[model samples]
Target: MRRVRTTHLVLALRGLGRRRVRDAALSVLAPVVACCAALAGLTAWAGAGRAGSPTRVRVTEGRVLLPSVGVPETAAFFRIANEGGSADTLVRITARDVPGDVTLSQHRMERGDMAYRSEIDSVSVAAGERLAMSPVGVDLTVPVPSKAWRSGDLVPFTLEFRRSGPVRVLAVVVRPGTVSPQ
Candidate 1:
């Protein structure tokens, strides 16, 4: 009787092992397929971000000066670098603390006199070239006189671009002879 019971137990164990062979293989396959799917999804998301983004828009230099009220207007100078692989435009700029609105202006000598004009929409900055918006040649003017800004006072402003959007910065007001901050 003991020998018959032992043979029955051995047959039951063999049946259990045969039933799990397919299930054991599927467990490993499930994890492998899930990992591959996750990797594919991440790769596609990264590609989409790169396709839409512009390469880079940077502020090389920005400064604001303090001069006498009789000067008519004060100017801020900046150097914008468009490192993006494509061309972009400096569309508009705004300064809030200033008493008047901002305008992009250019100065040129015509017929033995200095001619000044406003830049309306945008200033093009080529892919690799630099756009130098200087106070002397190309200037950004405040239409009215602002409250006197002391040295070291921070002037906050935003420069808007065509493709890259707006960049906010603080222009440190300094004396005429003092060095400007970066």
Candidate 2:
């Protein structure tokens, strides 16, 4: 009677499909596998068209101007140097610590009225040129107030390039009306 009961228990347990264990394991592991595959693809694709290293694009003298007494918005300046054999386009700029979007803007004279316009889509850097970002020319617009920005404050900035990927920069905050060098 003991041997017969053991055999019946074994048969009942075997009734559960053996493939159920494999299915459950696959369901748990599929998303992780897919994420790894997607990351690998992006890593390969980012290097497809770039001929030079990402370090060729450098940012120097990066600063965000402190907002004046009445102005709430501020401007940023940077000297972007492309020391590579291939030209690259600065496609995007992002700042996580700020409250507003970092927009690429340039002053335009429309109908004799000089205005700061957010019309620049992207800025291009030649093979061996240093693009000076200034308030008179193309600059980054941000909502950095005097309260938020102080002298010697460092803010994080990420500049995305068409060929070089993204380069991280630390922008220093300067005093109000600090004139950027020409």
Best by lDDT: 2
Which residue runs of candidate 2 sit more than 4 Å off their true CA positions?
1-55, 110-113, 145-147
- Per-candidate RMSD, Å: 14.8, 13.5
Model 2, residue 76: C-alpha shift (Å): 0.6
**Per-residue lDDT of 13-77 in model 2, one digit per residue for the tens?**
77655567778888989899999999988788567744444537888888988677677678888
Residue 174 accuracy (lDDT) in model 2:
90
Q: Each model's C-alpha lDDT?
A: 0.73, 0.81
lDDT tens digits, residue span 1-182, model 1: 99999999999988888879867888889999999999888788567554344647787556777766667667777888887766788878898887777888776657867665666566788765677766446667764345677777778889888888899978777566453323
Worst 10 residues of 1 by lDDT: 173-182
Q: Candidate 2: which pairs clash?
A: none
TM-score of each: 0.61, 0.64
Task: Give candidate 2's TM-score.
Answer: 0.64
At residue 152, give the lDDT of candidate 1.
78
